[model samples]
Target chain A: MSASSERWPLRKLIFDTLFFAYGVALFADALGAMGVSAFHFTQDDFIQNFSHYATFSLLLTGVMAIVALVANLRGWTTPGDALFASPLRKLELSARPWSRSPWLWQVVIVFTLTIVVSVRVTESSIGDLLDADGLQGAWRLWSGLSQPNFNLLPRALALAAETIFIAFLSTVLAIPAAFFLAFFAAKNLMQGPLALAVYAVLRALLNLSRSIEPLIWALIFTVWVGVGPFAGMLALTVHSIASLIKYYSEIIESVSDGPIDGIRSTGANAIQTVWYAVVPQIVLPYIAMTVYRWDTNVRMATVIGLVGGGGIGTLLIQYQGQALWPEVGCIVLVIAVIVWLMDTASAYVREALK
Target chain B: MSASGSPLLNVRSLGKTYPNGTKALSDVSFSVDAGEFLVVIGLSGSGKTTLLRCLNRLVDPSYGEIDFAGRRIETLQGAEVRSVRQDMAMIFQQFNLVPRLSALTNVLTGQLAHQPTWKSLLGLHSSTEREAALEFLKLVGIADKARVRCDQLSGGQQQRVAIARALYQKPKLLLADEPVASLDPATSHSVMDYLRKANRELGITVICNLHYLSLVREYATRVIALKEGRLVFEGRPEEIDRAWFQRIYGEEARDVGIQ
Candidate 1:
């Protein structure tokens, strides 16, 4: 990500020329727009390009400049002992004869204007945030939430248990799958063309699965499996596999090569070396990640049930649809308890391991 | 032991060109005799590590023959290569002990290749194997500290455990890749003394790569100097005078003797 500008003089020149042309064109256009002095430039629209070529030329020239900068920083550029070494001696913007103000002031104005424009485009209104009627409706919902609903308590407790189980099962299934895939996905483990190919394929598959949210996966699985906790667990499983693979593989890649090499030197073959050296180092971390993923999966499972994928959310949504706030309150309490318990359990397990 | 007394290891025109096109070593050849403490000395990036790696087939030589213990190592592959590696134990500059593991467990790793694959993976060593590993820890004078995690151990203690691990391999040759490079001056000598003990008492051939000429002169029965991937000198340590030292490690280089 670093380069020497000296290495690619031509690229630097191209970048300089484009940037210089843009500044000059803008300056000249501004002068003409103001009907000022001897700068006889004309413009149909204020912002539209009188020199549109300058903007487009920037795309290529900017890339070249970055490449040169990176090369220079990386020490790739050597001292040129040839002809045509003469580049622009100094590139000072303040020294430009036509410059009326510092570039920093212009940049500040541009950024401020961009934020102002964004605010207008988004149509945000602070005045509407605390509207009287909405406040009245919020009071009703708040009053209902405050009241107890012991009638739905038994059902809510069952749903809470089911939700936690869904998370547990999904994470349990994902762990072994992720554990195996991580070895293949790790850069250090993947040697030779075939292994690299497998790595790329596995990485692509993981990325594809991980990109979609568990809610979306739940929706698809709900359609396939027909609206149940089974669909929710399946959705969580897919996401956990991808997430765990990423976590596990990165840890695997970052493991100290010293111990691995030491084991290898002892004449352990590739499998033996990994089994003996790599496993011991990574096992503790892998267990921690498994617990972490299960925690995440539980959070995801709660949301998945909002789409009729089971748990207390399904019961809460059903009651809320009928405007049954007392029943909804019961389900919400159950969910809070479930989450707190999971958080405590995972933390305790992690602390105990250490 | 090779009673015939031919060189335990030999190299003929060993050369290595890495994938990125850096020639780490070129046309370098040397042989290690049985029961001799040989030292390889050079500045960093002078192919010392690469040479040790090649001897164990951790990195294969690009061309030329490596004859080790009468075995043609340069041509070795797969199981053949792995089996041959067991005979040559290597201790590294970093100590390379698995920090999280206990010192005893790290030493047990030295016997990983010698035992059944399933047993090593399960870490289910026999009581006899455990006793032998304990004996190695005792040899390195850290038997009392066997159950302590390697990361908790001092730098010198960790290195002693590393030496114990190497000795546990019961190897024909001990390849020390700047074994004391990471240690303090006092600890460096202590570690070197263990290597000397392994060579003198245990009769293990030691091919140690070192930076300090003082350590080389003190320990080495024979010495080989590598400069820019080529063997520049191969003679007795005392023969390397101030003039010869300049020739081996360029004129600008001064030997920073470690006390």
Candidate 2:
């Protein structure tokens, strides 16, 4: 057989060692669980549980082994006429242009190692985690899925309105603040220590606001302003600043500096420079970003509501705590529908802007 | 408009050393008479752009006095500088029209100095000003594309539109910095033709920087050559010979200019 057809010795050795180790670990665990003593490993209750739990995993490994075997068989070649026909083997193939690439082989080795390790780690008994009592409770929960209570519809609609209001208010508030911060951050627009200081301050503020999730912001606002949509709006506004600042700054940075220089050459003051050059270039992008942020804020508003910033999630939380499964499902469905519609509308608006 | 009047622009010992300590222009002194078409030529880093920009105080000269139309521009501050800039319109290599704005809107932006800040912000231009913008657009030969966005046009057409915008400013002096560098040969010729026409018809003192010696030879009445931030040659186009160009551009001249 040709050298290419021959099995790689190191690969074969590593595969065999891993397979043996897995088998030993499974056998040891099974023996210990069955209360077996000494070196003798017996097949008993532990073996039954282990085999039942690991049936799917064992099937997967067996399929992988079969596929590898087939690949090996395909690579095999006869020795006769191999010298002239398989000239690639005789030539310095490693010196070829493509042979310099090591990333492909690295990925293959890493993937194979991960699969082997995963198979070994998950071979023990786990069926007890899904016992009859546990399964029965899950079945009961699933069976409760039916029409939601129509009586709560009014409250749901009101909360939905609150969520929309919060999102709208917050997005509007964030835009102007982000606009100034973005100009400060753009390297082409500003230079030196002042620019650096402004950038650092803006970046720190953005990170600080975003680092504390909207849920945490809602909680803090609830304590400060009392539980209402106003609290929710304040929370969304702060969070929106963080998101908009990053997006606005990126847009500012990408703007063609040509017009800016042209305007500056006209002896247009700083404010005039921004109005004439920067604003004209970034207006469309800014509008698109605002619409997208509004959509995101709408989703976040609902989430924050669960923490007492009033919205649809607050009502959903109440129903969930009372085991109103059908109502919970309905609320989830409503949220999904709203998000999908908003996403589609936002996409259309963005396309129109472009 | 008198033929023997004082020069429209005067520069004395103009020098610029950037923040990074690189000298862009040094000891540059020149003057342009009213209604003069002076073309400046130089190598890539020869500081022609810096010198032109210093006329309006765009690039603040480290040591100089720029007196344009009898006004001391080098000492002007804030509104005073803006007033001088209003009288001096600049055209760039890239055309520099706001891409998103329509050609008409871009032209109207030149009238920004004349309009109230709030009125301009609201985009409320007087009907007469709008009509004048349209007239200038027609003069530049793209009046049909008045409502079209600038990005929709070819490079040459955009540069024409930029020239029209500069005309809309009604400036006494026009500065064009490599205005035809981005265009092909035919387009470059057409743009230079429009610039020459504007200079003659409007009586605007034109100071243009050109890289192509042939274009300068064909169009400019007076040519100024700068080398290493200093004026190396200054005379009428007829006076610029092979030896004079070689002195200014060195070995690179054999590859450049009309062959």
Candidate 3:
């Protein structure tokens, strides 16, 4: 074995210790839950609810603990497949896959144990998905969805139009705002203290705003602008500016310097230099990004109405709350068609630009 | 343009030490009479490019005075500095014309410093200026390539466009920073011939950096040598004998002919 594999690897040791601690805690909690101790990790109910996966994980944890202890005491590593290799290989040589890559096998076992333990802790189950009562409820929902209410078609179509317009208006509003702000945000163009200060502040603002989801922006705009498609448009516009500015600024930052030097060497002033050298190289890229942003905005516009920004989502949540599955289906279908069209159109436009 | 007995350009104690402590040029002093073809000979990083750039204020000299047309221009700032650059056109090793712009547009850029603010801002050159730019393109033998983007042109063609752009500026001093360094030997001679033509016909004082001593001998009226950022030799082109070449380029450096 190589020295690296022989030594107690830092990553493996850390992982084993952390997982061993979890096993110890689980055992302590279960022992305490039996009323032999005053405190426990949770209630006695948790002990009862612990699945077979946890018990199996506990046994694997015991095996790992023993192996780690032996390895540390003897200045060895992996002790893994090679230790159990003879017996397992005798049964089936290649079938015992760890014979090829012991570390991969170790990682797979650890990750599997972690996933099973997490699934049990979260109380997630296949049982709910297979239950008679749940299946009946799903059947009812499906039947209603299959038979969409045509009586609400006109209203749903109108709301769909409003959703698309909100996306369109916001994307249009964002273009000039983002285009101008991008120049200021680009580190290359922003020279001197005052310009650099603006660059720093604009970067912070863009980063802060971009991390927040458009849905959250919609919620805020609902309160500020009084629940309507206008609020949704404002929300999308704000988010688009943050996103477009980052993309646009990166594009501006990477522009070829040869042309910039050429223009500047000719004694062109600041604005003329950028106009002649920078802008020509950037126009096609900017147009492509705008199309891409519009496509994203269209997808977001359909969902922003749940909080009060009027659109298809407003109708979706309302109908869902009232158990009007057919009406909800109609709105979802409208959203799907518009989002699909925008996706296709933007892809085509961007490809043409390229 | 030799107006009087005084030299067209004079430098005294010129030096530039970059912020990173690279002493690119130091104590470099020389004078260029109007219409003289002066070539600067140095090994790579001997500060030949830095010296030419300093004359046009492309790279600010850390300390020195640059006297141009009987006026001190080293301390001149802002628009005045640009006016000085307008009279000292530069050609680069990489032929730094905007690759996406038409050859005509690239040539027109040379006149931008003298253009009205609104006119240049809108990229609207007057017909006379456009005609003059085309005339320069014709002069450089690339008139047919006026509408072609510079990036589409061959290496030799691109350098020709660069020379045309500099010629259109009609500068008193033409600064060519190893203008043939990136070109093939055949193209190298062609480019050097253009520089020589500009010197003789236009009466433009030329300060060129050259790598090949062969080209320097053929084209240069006078030559200056720099070693480790200090001027080591200043004389006629023929003065660079074999022993001097060994001293300038270092012993064990054999002179090889290019074309």
Task: Give the per-residue lDDT of model 3 (tens digit) for A282-347.
Answer: 988899998899888877887888877888878888999999998877777778888898899999
Chain B TM-score in each of the candidates: 0.97, 0.96, 0.98
Assess the local accuracy of residue B92 in candidate 1 as a C-alpha lDDT between 0 and 100. 94
What residue runs in model 2 are displaced by over 4 Å at the alpha carbon? A1-158, A176-204, B1-6, B255-259
lDDT on C-alpha atoms for all candidate structures: 0.82, 0.78, 0.84
TM-score of each: 0.81, 0.74, 0.79
Ranking by TM-score: 1, 3, 2
Which digits, one per residue and each the tens of the lDDT, describe model 1 over residues A295-337? 8787788889999788877877888899887778778888888
Best by TM-score: 1
The model with the greater DockQ, 1 or 2, is 1
- Which regions of candidate 1 fall more than 4 Å away from where they truly are? A1-123, A344-354, B1-6
| Top candidate (DockQ) | 1
Model 2 clash tally? Answer: 0
Rank all candidate structures by their DockQ, best first, as comma-separated numbers: 1, 3, 2
Candidate 3 wrong stretches, greater than 4 Å: A1-123, A129-132, A139-154, B1-3, B252-254
Which residue pairs in candidate 3 have backbone atoms (N, alpha carbon, C) closer than 3 angstroms, thus clashing?
none
RMSD of 3: 8.4
